[model samples]
Target chain A: MSTIFAHGGQLAHGVLLTMLMTVLGFGCALVAGVVLAVFHISPVPPLHRLAVGYVAVFRNIPLLVWLVLFVFGLPEIGLLYPLFGTVTAAMALYWAAFICEAVRSGIRTVPPGQIEAARALGFGFSQLLRHLVLPQAVRSMVQPLGTVFIALTLNTSLAAAVGVRELTGETQFFTITYDIPIPAFAVTTAIYVLITLAGGLLTGRLERKLAFKR
Target chain B: MNTGASTLFDLPGPAGRRRIRIATVVSLLLIVVAVVAVVRRLTTHGMLAADEWRVFTQWPTIRFLLGGVWATVLVTVVAMAIALPAGALVALVRLSRARVARALGRAYVEVFRAIPLLLLLYMFLFGLPRLGLTFPVFWQLTLAIVLNNAAVFAEILRAGILAVERGQSEAASSLGMTYWQAMWLVVIPQAVRKVVPALVGQSVRLLKDSSLGYVVSYLELLHQSQVLGEYYHTVLPTYLVAAVVYIAINITLSRFAHLLENRGLRGVRRRRHPESTALAENAAIGSGGRAPLIDDSTV
Candidate 1:
């Protein structure tokens, strides 16, 4: 226990960094994902195709591969960024595909009758989306978006591969220094579990509050 | 085509078609510009040089990477094989009447699900060696993957089991079947069928996790690329090739999952027409709402 406490400051810092990366990654993903999703469903043929290709490429590759590629490949092209920025960018790019799909699926959940009702009521594309589709879709989107965020948070642990010194990386240092790998990792694992559980609880409450009850 | 109905919009009018045509042209130009710019950057950096990529044409490099692919498949298959039965057992335990058994099973699932696979990989790679129970690197990676995926599979299987109509099991009990017999004969098989797509999705995840083999010196596909990158001094291109390979494999897996999902929908259609013979039972088996995978927690 003393061994664990001795690294309290490091653990705390690691947690902060982990949260920082999650927030940053999710922020970028939200913007990019929403844009890509708009492109996906829009009438513009080329943009829709572009969105399809983007999602396919990003979704099918592993997050670690993207990180390694960005970390190493970008520097080769003289586009050097800090390790934190590089890892966050890779994560955002990878997860944007998931968020885009979630948003598209969320839109799908809007009843066909509602869409037909709007169309019959003489609403244009923009008006129908603004008044009917988005309101319902965004509500349904909260749960899936929340799931993506949790997965993103779990993925921040991969930042340790690029030497971000986040929770996992800090745990690695503590384990080596103290020669107590199990206890060190156990503590790290507990911290991660707490983060995800808290996320789950919060998302559940928000979903209940926002549910589209008749 | 049903695509017109399936999308958010109706078929476009003349004005809408003209607008779409113009937008398509402009976007096409923009995409072309972006692609050209990226290619130019690569060319300038000599990143696309023929000499740099020549390493891949050699038979030895292909063989090496193939070995890595084989290692990755071996790990994924072994981990999945162990996880399926272990997860079913855990699901059964969680579904048990005893409160202690349920609580223990829930704890196992929750703990494992919340933890990152990488952290677990590290624990297996480094922590276990300290306890005088060191295994080979491949086993180390495989065991970590098994522990994590078994928890996820347990959740998925449990959802499938619960999604089953309660009446089926009750009828089995009324027919003088023991609890275990009812579960084995009536419940578990249907549960497995209902969640086969979700299970395939989990397999995609496990295959991805096998890339963590890089961390433990396991020489899986990703690690092999790293080694090739070092040897050829073509880090970017080698890793890019490996990334493409990963993408191709995973896309094929996801496509298979999609095929299974569509086949279930076809079963639904056959039920609607009532001309279905064996498909009536398939429709019944596939009728439940999709089972919740670990990442898709509505529970």
Candidate 2:
């Protein structure tokens, strides 16, 4: 793995870029997810239909196609965005459907009794959600959200298709071009494993911490 | 609707309805504007021109992509052929009473599950040849998909096994059956029924994930599309065609999974008596949780 040392700083930067993409993608997903979840649970039939339609189309299409569309088709349509930005945006849009589902599931887990208690106490819609429903929903959301984020990390590799030098792309460049396939892939895979395992461990701990209230 | 007390929101009054109508109008307008803008841009780029559209009639390119489709189907079948048995074995070992086997299985599942399938493909393709072990491009892609998907499938099976009630084995033991007999006959059958939808879902993902076979120069559907695009200078339509093709495959797979799930549900419903309706309800809840597919394609 000395080749790892040889490209030490570059590999570290690649890891950082991958992490950044994941965080950005996840951040976008959270915003879109909340909005979509709101639309899904909205009383307005049209809003609900819109949310359902969005999730249906986005969820079924592959992210690679999204990447292709954004990278090539967008510019043809005169939409200008950086390569990295476009890819992360595509990932966010794709993954937000998943996050929306998780949030919807969490909202469902809020017991009828709790909702009733909040209503009887004269809690308004936002107040009831904030104080009673959402707090409880948080406990149920940790595991699924964690899974989605980990998968998002894996998906950052898709950026390579559009020439973004994230971890997988960097590893590939070193392997195929630099002829250090074994060492580069080993190092890169190790980092991915470590990051994912650590994320899993954190989520497990979070689940346990939330276990009591549930 | 107004009679029920609510948590998220109360029923909208006339004012609220007006506001919702406005919001709905605005959202619909936004969608229309976006579509119109994209369509205008496409026209400006001559994407709808007869010359640009000519790629569709290019017999050579169509044949190439069709060949790629053939390669894709072949890879998925062969890979799953290997992965299914491997995953089953790993899941069984993980479910075993032996601590060592369980630990090994856990490690295998977690490690591989954490690693991206694309990285795994690269590892096998570029990494293997260095150790004086070369494989045909087809076998290389197949091995990569098999190895990674096996790990994912193992976890899916393990979870399914755990979801099953413990009393199944206990009843088997009382009937003088060994652990293996209980697992193979009683526990596994139930678990398999519960997990069938998930397994089929993962197969759809496998079909999509195999698109990464492009990177290794395997002439899969995506790669052939890329080649066609470069040749025809019609990147947009070429990739759009590829996307449509991929979508078609994915939709078909999910439909098959949906069909399998319904048939399985019918079987479960037919077998369960009124007293065991609780069991049927539990199956419904458990199966609603989608099976974890290997990659991001599990929708």
Candidate 3:
């Protein structure tokens, strides 16, 4: 316990980095994911196929493999980014595929009747999307997106693999240096639990606020 | 179910058809251009050098990598064997009438689910040795994965158990069955069947996670590829091949889950909202665990 308190500053930095990565990664994922979802459901056939292929390829691969590839392999082709930037980008690219699916699923929740009603009212494609589909779809998406965010937060630990010194890395440092594995791990686990609990609560609140009323 | 694209847009009139056709062609051309540029860049960097890939054709190299695949499968199989039954037990405990049991179960699932698998693996790999409690490297990786995945499987199984209609267990009780007997005989089997697709989906995650064996020097596929790449001095190409291999195996598993869903084997409760149902499937697909449970609060 003393060991944990002694390293409180390091742990705090780890938590901050992990949070930064999750937020940045999720932001990138959101933009790419929404675009992919639109392309997936767009009237354009080839773009739909491209989106399908993109999700399949990215979603199927492991996050660690993607990170290693980006961190180590990309330099062979002259595309170099900082270690932190590269890992976050890899995470964003990988998770964007999942977010695309979540968004697509959210869109599907907008009932066929609602869509038909919009068509009957002579709404154009863009207007239907803006006025009817996206609003409700975005509402339904909140919970799932929250789930994705939590998962991303946990995954940010993998950034430690490429030398990000996130929560997991800091925990390792404490354990090795102080020879207090139990205290080190327990403190880190508690911090992670707190992070996830906070995320879940915030998401539940947002989900309720955004929920569509009949 | 309706195809999402078709539902999003009206059936094309002649003008719409023409527009779609032009859009398709334009998108195809853009994709082709992107591909060409990527290929050109790789060529310029000598990344596409034929000799770098030639190792794949050799029987010895192929055999070596297959050994890695076998090791990965072995780890995944052993971990799954332990995790599946353990997860069921955890799920049953969470469903127990005793509040203490439920809390303990929830704590187990929530903690493991919250902690990343790599951190757990590191604890096993590095921490336990200091306590003079070392297992073989294989058990270290496999057990770490089991700890995390058992919690996940518990959540998936709990979802299935809850999805089973309440009346089924009530009927079993009316027939003079004990609560445990009803759960074991009537409820659990049906629950397992309902969530088999989700279970398969989780297995894909397990299989991909087995690749983390690379971190512990377990000589899994990625590790083997890394060694091979070092031997041939073609690290990027080797990792790409390994990535392709991981993608191929996971894609097959994911497709199986989709097949099960499409065959109407998802669960007993038919979700009224298409978004809810889709999110459920996406939960299995996307997240580590926490698969949009019957009651989301439990997570």
Candidate 4:
């Protein structure tokens, strides 16, 4: 294990990729979720329906379905990302549905009186959403959204199915190459466990801080 | 997770309604254009052909897939069987009086919950050969799924346990019951009832996750779909079929769970609310378990 780490073996690289994918996928989920949530709550009936339909389809379909479909179907639509990119993109889309739900619910936590006040002050739709609604919505969202993103951390390993040499793939590759399956698996598993524990703790702390500020 | 009666602004006036109508038309146009682009290409490739779907009725393919469904169900049943009880025990350990027991229980839940189910599956399936205990694909996959879910179940059960009023336990102890007696006879049963919806959600997750067994060559429903693809030289059709199967099974499972939950809810005589703890539990535990595609809380 020490030698593998010292030489930056496949397992090490895989662990690195896993964390990278989590951060990247999580960022995409956040942005896409905010967009979808905005459309969902927008006064425009068609835009709201479109967003609702988006969440319905994406959320109903399993991540595996999107991963497989994007791999096989994207080129037909004239989108051509590599295996890793496709997997990450699909994950972001899948997670965005859940994030949209969290964000929508968070927006609900913003009192109706607040919206009325903003309207009375002549705040436009965009201005009200940007200046008034989003700030408070985000605060309520911090904990639930944190939990969802932490789940994203584990789902990153699913990328390995489409031939991304993330942690799981790396674990298999290193195990095969070094003929040290037990140690390789043990080490990679431990790293993920530690990361998950840390994420949960960090989110809890963040939630507390947000609560205190409120 | 379930957003109730929420709107961004007041109902639109006449002018506002006109804008909304225009926005609807524009959104529909965009969606139609995108859908057409994809459909046109698929038609060009013969992917939309009725002939490709006839294989769904073929005995060889259907039987193979049916076998896969059984495999998926078997995995779910076995994992749930072990994980549920084991999770409860772990929850007890988490709430144990002993510091070491609590720490060890916490470590177990944290570790298993953190690791991806697929990676854990790989670790057990591939790594076990090095430990002189290679399991059949079934056992290996089951072990991974059970371990992964048990940690999460433990946490959920722990929360449910905590949610039970402390006074109940106090009353039990004051009545000359031992701590174990109070927990066994009083606390656990109530906790389980309160969290039935969450447990049901987890069970469905175990079913869906069993599809991951395909990676290890478990010949589960997803793998059988791949087998159909291999023979037919068509990937999307086979995958779509598999997804349909998964969706159907999950829908049924959740429906049954809801039925059971409704009966329980009625007996408990809880106040009826549109948004139950079920959705909230689904969202929170789903962060750790499987996500429901449609809002199950609507049931």
Candidate 5:
């Protein structure tokens, strides 16, 4: 207990880094997911094929492999960066594939007639997407999106392998430094549980509020 | 629905006109660049360069990775085997009239689903050893996978059960069947058909997630690949091979799921139409001031 309290500042820093990675990864996932989803549902055959391949490649490979590739491989070919950017970009790219699939399904749940009606009302493609399709899809996608967010949060722990001082990495560092593995990881696990529960509650509340109008 | 009437000229206005043009141009440009890049890479690094291809011919590493693949398959199959029956039981408990069972089942699902698989892996792998109750690494990894998947499978099974129409149960009961018999014979078969696709998808996810066993020093495919990369100093090729293997397995599983979904849809279509028509007619009669005549007593 004394040792853990002694390392409280390190634990706090670890928790903060974990939250930063989660938020950054998830934000990138949302933007990339939307783009990929649109590409997938586009009418062009080649675009659809490209989107399908992207999802397949990312989803099938383990996240660890992708992180290693970006962290180690990219620099070999001359694209070098800070460890944080490399890991974050890789995590975002990997999870974005899943997010794309979820978002595409949400888009499919929207009635086709809604888009048709927008078209009939002289709405441009952009206008129709912004005004009609996206709002409805966003509302319907809350649960799956939340699931992806939680998954991403857990997965960011993989960044520890690349030397990112996230929660898992920090705990490992403290364990080795202080010769106390159990308490260090226990506290780390508790912090993770707390963050995930808070995220779940916030998303659940948002889902309910969004549904009230319906 | 005059499909032919809406030609390009018939589209409403100039609102979409410029946007469509810009989208087309940008997409074409992206496609060209992508094609060029692929062609350049393939030509520069031929399909079978000695440096890239030599890793597979290394007997020891290949053997290790193959062994790891078998472990992955075994873990996935065993976990799914355990989870399916357990999930069905939990689903039944959730749907049962017993209040305590329902609460217990719901709590199981929520707790397991809320916890991350990695944390559960850590608990079983490291935490239990501290309590002086240790499992072999394989069993530890398998337990973690099974527990995580069982929670997801329970949800899938519950949704499947809920999809079974109420009339089917009533019909089975009218024929003097017990609740369990009706559930087993009439309801579960239909429910399984509805959820088989989702079950396969989850199984694929389980297979992928098993790679996380690397964290616990389990010698799965991902771990083996990492070992090879560390040995040869060629991380990219080893991982490329691993990624290809995973893609192959996922595609195969997805294809099987597609086949099952098609078969289930056909079966449902064969049975649903007549029953739906009859129910519609009966509903009309009841709304027109006639009793359902089958009676509340029969239920």
Candidate 6:
């Protein structure tokens, strides 16, 4: 049991991996989400349909299933990979669908008058999107995006199934090795609670700041 | 932002058309590439072995999956049953005149809401034994779901309750109802109606999140799928089936909610609007008013 904490370095390594996955996956999801939201709200009929379908499928399917499909199912045809990359890619893809919808909702909340104003000011499509639409949309998006980030952080725990030594995986390893499930898991839960609370606090402050700006 | 319908198609002529065409082609090409990559991978690896496919058809896996479905349903129903009442209580507590009760209610909500559902399940399953409390797998899972979901539902219900007109509560009190009676009989009824859509939405979420039980080795659908995958080494098919089952169930539930929402609105109109009620009653009286009376009373 003493050996578990004695090897605190291993736990730190796991925490590092967890943070890396959260940042990378969420970063990718944000970019993909913005792009998809643009397409979804665009005047192009085909793009709109495609974006809708993408959201429907990904949003409906379980994230674990997506992870399995990428890790186990994808390699069958020859797209082999290191497990880490596969799991990360899968997480990014799955969350991208959700984030896209959030961004779209945010974008929709921007009044049409704002867009019209931008147009009347002689703004082109790109300019209007960059200057007027995106800034307001992003403001409205702060709260939802914060929730998504927390979700992404929590969901990264699922990557443990694919053998990524994230915090959960490390806790599992210590539990099995020490044969003391309670203490190991207690520590894990505490860590999770701490991180989530910090996130909530930070996001709450940001939300207030954004509201004040408006 | 009413940009008007004409703005949708008012692109800047030939160059704009050409650019749009190029953009469409590029997006399509990207999707095609991704699809081809996925298809190529799926076909080559032969995800399910022949024997594994046979095993999936076997009675035990079938029974297990079906049993998992039942467990999932039971857990959801029981959890929501508990959560609804518990959530209402918590909401009432939060809205109570007493500061201590409100603080306690608010604390419970914040703590539970911030904690991930999966971690809560783990705590219930593994943590309780140390404190000399034990529950069977089903109860443990159900309790975890209820606790986590109640926190969320409490918030939702409180929002709904707050959305109700302050006059409604005052009116109930003015009519000689006690605070509790006013809450339960008047405030809650209206609040529930307003929150029906969101309640259904959360129920769908609960159904999906129940899959998290797999982590604690609860034999829900995902757990059943994992077992089959371990046995037959057909990880993908088993999960695919589970995913499809979940999606099908949720879609059906959502459609039902939509139907109920439409019916409920109609019901509200017929009951609340005296003019509509009179018209409906008159139309019914011409054809025997019993049916409309029954409908109106039900609403």
The candidate that achieves the highest TM-score relative to the unseen native structure: 1
Please write out the lDDT profile of model 3 over residues B220-278, one tens digit for every residue. Answer: 99889889888998889989988898877777666655666555524523634565456
Quote the lDDT for B297 in model 5.
10
Of the true contacts between chains A and B, what fraction does model 3 have?
0.62
List, residue by residue over B155-242, the lDDT tens digit for candidate 6: 8789878877899899999999999899989988877765666577678767877777676678888888888777776777778878
Model 6 C-alpha lDDT per residue in residues A1-214, reported as the tens digit of each score: 4665788888888889988998999999899988887777666556777887787677666676677667776554567898888888888888887788677656756777777777877888778777776777777777777777877887788787667888887877776666667777767767776777777788778867767352
RMSD of 6: 7.6
lDDT per residue for candidate 4 within A72-103, as digits (tens), equals 64564456787877888889998998898878
Write candidate 5's Cα lDDT for B115-233 as tens digits: 56766766675556766878888889888888877877888888877877999999999999999999999999877765565566677778887787677778888777878877877
Docking class of 3: medium
DockQ of each: 0.59, 0.47, 0.58, 0.45, 0.28, 0.27
Lowest summed-lDDT stretch of 10 residues in model 4 chain B?
Answer: B290-299
What TM-score would you give candidate 3 relative to the actual structure? 0.91
Docking class of 1: medium
**Candidate 5: clashing pairs of residues:** none
lDDT score, candidate 4, position B163: 77
lDDT string for model 5 (A1-214, tens) is: 6898987888788888888999999999899988898777764456667787898788877787688778866654456899998899998999888888777656755666666777788877677778877787878678778878887887788787667887887777776678676776667767776777787788789888887473
TM-score of chain B of each: 0.87, 0.87, 0.85, 0.86, 0.76, 0.80
| CA-lDDT, candidates in order | 0.83, 0.79, 0.83, 0.77, 0.73, 0.73
Q: DockQ-based ranking, best first?
A: 1, 3, 2, 4, 5, 6
User: Which whole-number lDDT from 0 to 100 does residue B26 have in model 3?
Assistant: 88
Candidate 1 per-residue lDDT, tens place, B79-173, comes to 99999899999999999999999999999999998889889888887788898888889888999899998998999899888977899899999
Best by DockQ: 1
